[model samples]
Target: MNDKKSVLRSSFLINFAIGLLIFFAFTIGLTTKVYIGGGIELYGTFLLALLILALNSPYVKHLSILSKNQALVLILIAWVLINNAELGRGIYERLMFTLFFFLVYLFISEYNEWTGFCLNSIKVLGIVYAMLTVFFALNTGLYVNIVMPVFADYTSIYQQNYAFLNGYLCGFTPNAAINAIYILAALGVCFSNVIVSNRRKVTSWILPFFLLGILFMTGKRGHLIFCLIALVLVYFINSSEDIINKYSKFVLITFGLVIVFIIAVQYIPALANVFTKFENQTEMGRIDSGRFDIWNYAFGSFLKSPLWGHGWDSFKYLFEPVYGYQINVHNVYIQLLTDVGLLGAIPFYCFFIMSFKHVKKAFKFYKNSTDLKAKRDICFALYIQVFFLLYCLTGNPLYDATPLFLYIISCAIGEYYYSTRNKT
Candidate 1:
């Protein structure tokens, strides 16, 4: 019994460390590169997580049985990697990120009881991220002029042309798209805390809206739309007749707050800037903001090599000559189809379909569950999954550490909940 307790404690600490590393990596956009190296540096939090796994190898068990959906995703990932092998080092980096997250998922699934540790760790990280965002927004000049320059060497992409009322608050990453997703994920964590009763009602209510405020500050219309949609889904899906009755006062108060915020925004000229920017950007001529041109060029390239397609990370190479500036396809599905062709896209599509199916099953199970915590966990996982699906429509969430790690964590928790319930 003592030995078992020690193992559990050690596992929880390791999981907590992993969670912290993931959040740190996401905040800094350190997903692909670590600075310390002569030729080949370590990449992201995966190496640290991998070392922890090695230390705990005795506790790690090989998965003897995979659900059909799980097996299909693995097959799809393998197919994508195998066909893109000619990309060499580029492909290897991508493979390592995927494999590291996969191993983390497997470990968590096997130790299903540790889901609480993961949730608490993420909640702490979310709170810190939210605080930083608020601070940066309030001091945009300081962040841009002082903080940003300090990390100039690590910055990958910075949009100098995009204008915002207060200047975009990208936190550590220069890419507003990545910053938007991080804010959304932080909101999900706050929402989960509210549902689980792990946080005070007031704190829970304020945190999400606060995070949403930062998200809007980033001027990412797609992310803001998808986040609102995810929140609505989470509320309706998890709200039972009894639960609704219990929280009716809280719900009414929240509704009142939204109304008050809207009225206040109209009176405050400064507050109206964000809304005006969004309205102006929605004009039919400016809606896509030049993405259509890039998408068209990418599609044309795909047509040239329909079957095998360009190699991994080949979109920029193929489009830059024609477009004059290097840009991604902007749409992940289209990007995959263009990069790997029809054959590779089959498995990629299958992976998402399978993942959704698994989450749907878990959602249904928890909806009927008598345990409140189980229901909250399921709802939280579902919200994150929705965010992932919606974000993929406009950005490549698969390649980024923030969204990918959150997706993996949510799926692992859901799978653990489903498996444990069945065993009982």
Candidate 2:
């Protein structure tokens, strides 16, 4: 048994290392500029690692039993991909996303091992990113034009405009929306650790504050709001009385500081002026900076084919005439509606809802669990799902690899826990 566990651990670490490298490659320009036959040919290393892990994983034989909802979700994904292929648009992209989702499900179905590794990995990466941001801020004095050329291309144009705010913490991919997702996911892991362990480690307290600071500095208002909501939900949804008692004071103090900061911003002239400029950058009424027009256009496109919808990647073509450039609708639900229509969306919605249902079951199971590690694992999984669900409202998480990877892994962890509970 020990030997088997060792093998599993080794495989997971190898796969995880490959995944991190792939993430950094895209972020830092290693593979971002690499293309073959006029198409970006990244993910070769990630796919190979995934293939190896799948081969070694005992769960491969039981893939069909991974979750009660897996089959239905798979069918829906197939339907969408088929429809996109029929339209001769976005077939490659949709197919890649489908494969990535399947692999995440397969790997994370190992439950305790793979899921724990993933959660820890997220926390570590978050801390590393936060520290890097601080280091860069101090070294460069938050200069706008002091970017590493290799990493600069991965950031969004809007982020580039306020590069001073981003600092050098972005590593490779510095888009504010994406950074927000990373920070929130990491924070969820750390929060779960505190709750599950029923003790507050120094890292637990420090890491969250560091991540929150990074999120605020990103100037991504939508993500910041999502993070706040997720944090509050995690705190209340956690059913551990001991954990609550231990950290309740900290939570209250944090809220108090936030309120005091707001009051100070209003009273201090220089601070108020800075705050006003920040607000202007993130304010929804800023036309080009706002998502309202993009959402409206996506809705109109959805209305065009309410039943079947336009195929995947159709929004760019549909909206370019009006917006004069191609971009996502900035809302996952609206994007799904525009891409797959109501028919395809029904199963898609069911897939996510069912995933959350498993998470809910895991939460209840852990509430009564005696094992501290198991309890913490489920809590972390639940928090990650909640964060993703809320973040998806204002971001195209479906199209982004990092966020999508974390979301599916959380679902798989929940499903795994739910299945284990039933077996006993």
How high is the lDDT of residue 270 in model 1?
36
Q: 59 in model 2: Cα distance from truth in Å?
A: 4.1
Task: List model 1 lDDT by residue over 67-144, tens digit each.
Answer: 554566566556666666335644465556666776666555544455566666666665566567567667777776
Question: Candidate 1, 371: how far from true, in Å?
Answer: 3.7
Question: What are the per-model C-alpha RMSD values against the true structure?
Answer: 3.9, 4.4
404 Cα displacement, candidate 2 (Å): 0.8
User: Would you list the clashing residue pairs of candidate 2?
Assistant: 27-172
Query: Per-residue CA lDDT of candidate 2, range 1-424, in tens?
Result: 9999977677667557446533532243333455432224445645665675666555674554545576765676577666672346433644565565656475556545655566777787776765665566566534344544444665555655564543323532454455556666777787777766655676767667666667666556666666677666666676546766747876787788688667854653322332444566567467346688788889988998998888866787787797688788888899889988998878878878988898888788778677777777777777767777877787777767667777777787788788788664
Using lDDT as the measure, the top candidate is: 1
Off by over 4 Å in 1: 20-24, 30-35, 38-48, 51-63, 89-95, 154-166, 196-204, 242-258, 266-274, 368-372
TM-scores of all candidate predictions against the true structure: 0.83, 0.82
